[model samples]
Target chain A: MAISSFHPPQRTLMGPGPSDVSARVLAALARPTLGHLDPAFIGMMDELKRLLQYAFQTENAMTFAVSAPGSAGMECCFVNLLEPGDKVIVCQNGVFGGRMKENIERCGGIPVLVEDPWGRAVDPDKVEAAFGANPDAKFLAFVHAETSTGACSDAQTLCAIAKRYGALTIVDAVTSLGGSPLKVDEWGIDAIYSGSQKCLSAPPGLSPVSFSDAAAEVIRQRKTKVQSWFLDLSLVMGYWAGEGKRAYHHTAPVNSLYALHESLVMLQEEGLEASWQRHCDLHQQLKQGLAELGIEFIVPEGDRLPQLNAVTIPAGVDDAAVRAALLADYNLEIGAGLGALAGKVWRIGLMGHAANQRNVDYCVAALREVLSR
Target chain B: MAISSFHPPQRTLMGPGPSDVSARVLAALARPTLGHLDPAFIGMMDELKRLLQYAFQTENAMTFAVSAPGSAGMECCFVNLLEPGDKVIVCQNGVFGGRMKENIERCGGIPVLVEDPWGRAVDPDKVEAAFGANPDAKFLAFVHAETSTGACSDAQTLCAIAKRYGALTIVDAVTSLGGSPLKVDEWGIDAIYSGSQKCLSAPPGLSPVSFSDAAAEVIRQRKTKVQSWFLDLSLVMGYWAGEGKRAYHHTAPVNSLYALHESLVMLQEEGLEASWQRHCDLHQQLKQGLAELGIEFIVPEGDRLPQLNAVTIPAGVDDAAVRAALLADYNLEIGAGLGALAGKVWRIGLMGHAANQRNVDYCVAALREVLSR
Candidate 1:
């Protein structure tokens, strides 16, 4: 059988992630590939780290991008910071937090899960109670913005509660980073992992992660070797730490990093606060339009993530048929609910470059047409 | 402090891996970001698997690309197949073999080392003897082509010996797949992994891997869960299988997979035998030119990989200074030796798109000029 080059359709990505990438970012991705250790490439990597630090709003020396996706970045935090028999308090409200539990278990850490109902923020009181009961817990982990439910947790409150109990925090900022107000250093987030495809407006593949000094110190003092060698921060830091004479790690995803650098630079140019406001403004517009169509949100207004809007599927509306129609007719891609919310909700994303009046209007009109038909 | 967008210099990459991506592949990478689970994206992924199967020359149903780099692919093989308390025979001749040992230990498997000198291919006799000594060994893992030492082991002979002892074999074809002759099914390799950056002429980040029916069965029947959830084949297969309703794994590194698809398509256009011959032809040209400058190869002609030429550095040559001059003065990048051979050898790569006569001539001329200075 003969195969030819794939010409992907120009998609309006209004899904959970891989949010619409700007042409400038795409152009950056197509730039000439360079050797991972090339001096010029290394210089660019240093700048990439700086840009990531700014996006994360932290001065973490261990800030850099993981070569894989956000899942691997989540593993990096757990496998490095927690060892066998270590106790951790994990809050589960969405798919990502559940993944954190899996990572903890794989690393041989004992997890005490604080459960929250779906379409709701992680209950800070429940997390505090978990810490109170398991006073020896070494880490407190939760998702800052749950992509599966579009629920936004209060990361600062959770981190402060964890710190009061002397437990470090690992936050999943995959869908929250640039779309919302997140101050890593000021919020006392010890370790945070995010994706380039979300609010960063880059293509998928690279995961931007940061570790504070306290988190770095815990990794340095590990009694056991990191369970997953590929996700080990101790060795990864040597490659990303742009000090004198950098060490060789794996060949970084050179082109993906190029895309990330461009996206982060755009974030810097727009300023983090402005990017957050843009997402919020677009969310308001989308909300008003959806409400007019008699659609209801799964998450409450106060707890909703501006970047990702989770709405209840109206009765008698075939969930798959509507989403399929949206893609087939409008060339728009919105997400279907995952896990417990499967077939019950649709996720509409207004993230990074996708957060604009044009996309919002197109999405609303498309939904109206599809629903009416 | 303000930072501008990064503009990487156009470099002629003649390194160990990431050996010059083609413009078409780069363009494919930048085409358009798609939601990972989009129907069109899934169609592209199905085609990607077919293309990968052709490249690996396998009928293995479980063939697909890992979302991370080659190292993660390596971990995937070990973590999925070998559980705690299992014994495996690991052949250590170069850098990657040593890494396999680390992965085995991290997975709680006992590794019986079959040691060969650096720059030498794996000895089948030593492997058989290790099997003789440890009759209960579950796996035999070795590198088919050692990128660090530019040595090509006899994969067919090694796999035949491992099968005789009822042990599954895992082959690292990172630098071998397109540049050399490798038949995964015919060679009886139970599992194999390759990097996209090397012979595929794609930018770094994706690892194309294949598992034989026997290997997949072992993974399916594992008593314990795969240690790394992100790299776990059990979960990953559902997403890549593409036969029925595809399951969602981590967002499929959508753009990277697009680049891999284009590269594999190009590989099909140029027949595999032709690609191998091209690398061999370029290697001969490079070898003769290096010999004229009084440089010698570390590996014997029979064992040396045609794509990666490892040559002994002159006794008094300032290795770093020479490499820096090649980069700054000529815009060419060659790799320095790693681990045991560091500072003693230079690795000049002629793989995929970089294996043309123009690159060969330019690399030799640049080396001659830099060496004379």
Candidate 2:
């Protein structure tokens, strides 16, 4: 059996990421594939690390992109920092937070769970209380912007709380990096990971991550070898460390890095704060439009994420049917609620290149036409 | 500080892996990005699996591409199959075999070393003896093609030997697939992994992997959960399994899959045997040219890999200076030897779309001009 070339249909991606990539990033992905060790390529890699530092709002020397997706980035943090039998304070409010617990446990770390309702922000007081109860906890982990429920937690407050307990923090900034204000250094985040497709406007593949000096030291002093060699920071650092003297760890996803470098360059052109405001502005426009259509949000206003808007499914509406119709009729893609919120809510995303007045208006108009029928 | 878009220099790639990619694969990568769960995207994914199956020459149901590079693929096999305290025979011929041992030790498995010379294939007699000494060995791991030394081992004999001792086999075919005769099913390889950049002529990133039915059964009946959640086969299987009813694992490298699909399609069009023969033909041309220039191969002819040629550096020649001159003067790239062979040898790759008479002639002509200077 012979397989032909795949020509993907043009899509308006406003779902839980891979949110619309711009033509610039796509063009970058088509650039000639260079040898990973080529001097010209290494120059671009150094610039990429600097650009990633700017996007992450940190001056971390350990900042680099993982050659895989976001989940691998999460695993990298857990495996490198936590050892067998270590204790961690894990906050579980949405799907990604649950995944964090799994990472912790798989690394042989005992997690003390801090639970909150799905559509609400993680309760900071509860996290503090859990830390107080489990004083032996070496790390605190949570998601800043929960894509599953569109709830935004107070990262600054949580990090401060963890610091007070003498514990390091691992923050999942996958949905918050460019769409929201995330100051890795100012907020005292020790280790943070974000996805390229989320708000960077690159295709889904690379995970941009940063570790503070303190976190790097902990990795350097690890008592046992990292469980996942591919995600191990010690070995990976050698490859991503210096400009000309770098060692070969693995063949980087060359084209994917090209796309990411372009996306980060675009991010620099439009300043970080301006990008965050754009997301907020588009979310406001979408909110007003949805309100006029009698749609209500699942998350409260204060706890909501501007990039990911989770809303209640209207009574008597067939959730999958409506989403399928929108895709079939208008080529618009929104996300269905995952895990506990499945069939109960719809997640509409306004992220990076997808966040604009035009996309907001088109999504609102498409939903109205499909729902009223 | 502002940064401009990166325009990478166009260089002829002839490194160990990440060989020259075709215009067709690059164009496929630049196509519009799509949602990972979109129906049309799912259709492409199903097609990708079928294409990968054809490339690996297997009918195994658990065939798919890992969303990372080859190292992650190596981790995926070790973590899922071996558990804590499990003993395995690890054959070491070059850099990758040592990496496999590190992976085993990290997974808490004890590695029984079966040592061979650096530039030679794994000795099948030594492997059989190691299995005899360690009757409790659960796995026999070896590299089918050592990219570091340009040696190709007899995968058929190794797997057959492992079977006789009631041990599963893990084969690293990173540089062998599509460039040589690798019959996954006919050789009875239990688990195998290959990189997209090597013989497939796609850009770096994405590891195509396949597991026989017996290996899949062992994974299903594992005593403990897979150590790394991101590389967990049980959970990943759910996402790659089923047609149109797939579950979400992580967001796949969407555009990378497009490149792989195109590469595999090209491979299918030139039949596997034809592709292998192309590499062989190009290798012969390169060999004759290099011989005239007084270059000597590191590996014996019988065990040498046509895709990767490791040649000894001539006495009194400045290795780094010559390679740098080749890059600067002719816009060409070759590989420096790794590990013990570093500075003593140079690796020239002839794989996939890079395996052609034109590249061979250009490489030889460039090398001769630089060396004579």
Candidate 3:
């Protein structure tokens, strides 16, 4: 069977990640493939580790990308740190948060879920109360930026509460790392994971993860062996640590890591706070245009994520039809609501390289044209 | 914090895996990122699905890449198909087959192991006898190419045995696909998984997997839910089915899929028989050169893999020092044996684009130079 050469249309990506990869990242993806253990590649791996430390705002030595997507990052963090019968407090705000609860249960951890409305952010008070109720919980897990609902929770406050109760914190910053303020050290976050596609403008394979010293100590002291050998950080550390000698783990996604390093390099070039500000600026413009088009935002103004915008479907409009029309007619892509809020909202992402004035305007004009018909 | 650009050395990769990526595949990886659901991207996804079908030599519609390494691909197959209390017969000849046993227990399935020595092929007689004893087993799993020991097992005979017992087969062709004959349909193999890096000449982020209609029927008829949310094929199939109406699973690793597609295209261009012949020819030359140097192979003739040649280290030689000397002096990389064979054997790979006269000459010359010191 013969396959044609791929040439994708230059569409404006307003969907959740993969947002838009920069030209630099794309070129890096095409860069020459190297053996994963090559000294040059290992040197680059060291730079990637440092860049990840900067991205996650952590000083943790055990920082690197998992050779998988954000969901695998979730699995890596959960399966490695939590053993059977371990108690975890999961705060469910959106689809990703619900996934955290699922991971906890699947990893043989007892999940004490603190529920919130689908479109709203997780309440810090509710989390504190849950910790009070489940004082024996070993860790607190929550999403910093809920991609499905475009709501940003208070990760710092959540981590503070967990630390007060002598528990570790696992933060899912899949959509927040470069779009908002995530201070892993300042907030005392024990373990944090992010997606390269969301706000790093890289292809969606590598998941950047960081762990504080305390969390590393806990993993080192685990009573049982990590269930999933593929994701065990203790074994993977030998490959990614870049300190002394490197050992053979699984073959790393070498080109994908190159793309991630390029994306992170671009972020560093743009300046992290400036990049966050740009996402906010684009979000404001997108918010204004959507309001002009008679669409309402699902998330509250104060809690809304700057990078991901969740807009409610207008009455009598076919949600799927509008998205389909946008894709077919305008070549603009957006995300449908997930889980409990499915068919009720559309998630338009203004993330990383995609968070620009041009894309915001194009997405806004395209939506208006599609919905008007 | 400052970060430097990634510049990988142009080294000839002749290691066990992560073989040299073709320029066409690298170019495909640099393509612009698109939403996983964009129409143009979906069209490309259709092409990828068709290409994967050709590579696996099957018409299984559920075939697609797991967005992780080969190990996670193994997990996806076992976890999605086997539920708790399910009985599976795993044939362990090398590290990967032992990994299958781990996956079985992690997914809560009972494992019946058929053991063979590390440097030997899986004894089909042992597997058939195991089926005789455990006729109620739902599935049989084994590695087609044992990467650790460079042994080639009789997958066709094993699959035939499993079929006679009305059991499905899971074959780990991670190191064998595209290097040798792999007729998924003709052999009646139920489920097969392979890594892109081995012989596809792509990076290692994606795993190509295909399932028979019979295996799909079992997944459809499972009594309990698949535990891993990310690897649940039901959700993944909705996105990767190559249909116009693609559901949102996790974001696909866009550029990596492009690389996999391009590699498959390159394979088709070379023709499977020609590619297999190239590997055989190169392996013969490499064997002659090693024989001239008084080196001995681990696996017996006819059982040895053409792509992965496992050679026993000289008794007086320092394995680590010699490998380090080769890396430092010549920038050539070769595999040190894994698991039980570690420090005892050197695995020389003639895989995909790395299977050539130049690579064979370079590695042999480098070994001779390094060993003389």
Pairs clashing within candidate 2: none
Question: Cα lDDT for residue B58, model 2?
Answer: 95
Note the DockQ of each predicted structure: 0.88, 0.91, 0.66
lDDT of 2 by residue, A28-118 (tens): 9999999988888888889999999999889999999999999999998999999989999999999999999999999999999999999
lDDT of 1 by residue, B1-373 (tens): 7778788888898989898989999989989889888878889988988888888999999999999999999998999999999999999999999999999999999999999999999999999999999999989999999999999999999999999999999899999999999999999999999999999999999999999999999998999988899999989988988575888879878988999999999999998889999999989999999999999999998999999999999989999999999999999999999999999999999989999999999999999898887
- Model 1, position A257, has a per-residue lDDT of 96
Question: Worst lDDT window (10 residues) for model 1 chain B?
Answer: B240-249
DockQ of 1: 0.88
What docking grade does candidate 1 earn? high
Taking all chains together, each candidate's TM-score versus the true structure is: 0.99, 0.99, 0.95
Candidate 1 segments exceeding 4 Å error = none
Candidate 2 local lDDT, residue A347: 94
Residue A56, candidate 2: C-alpha displacement in angstroms: 1.2
DockQ of 3: 0.66
The parts of candidate 3 lying over 4 Å away from their true place are: A314-330, A368-373
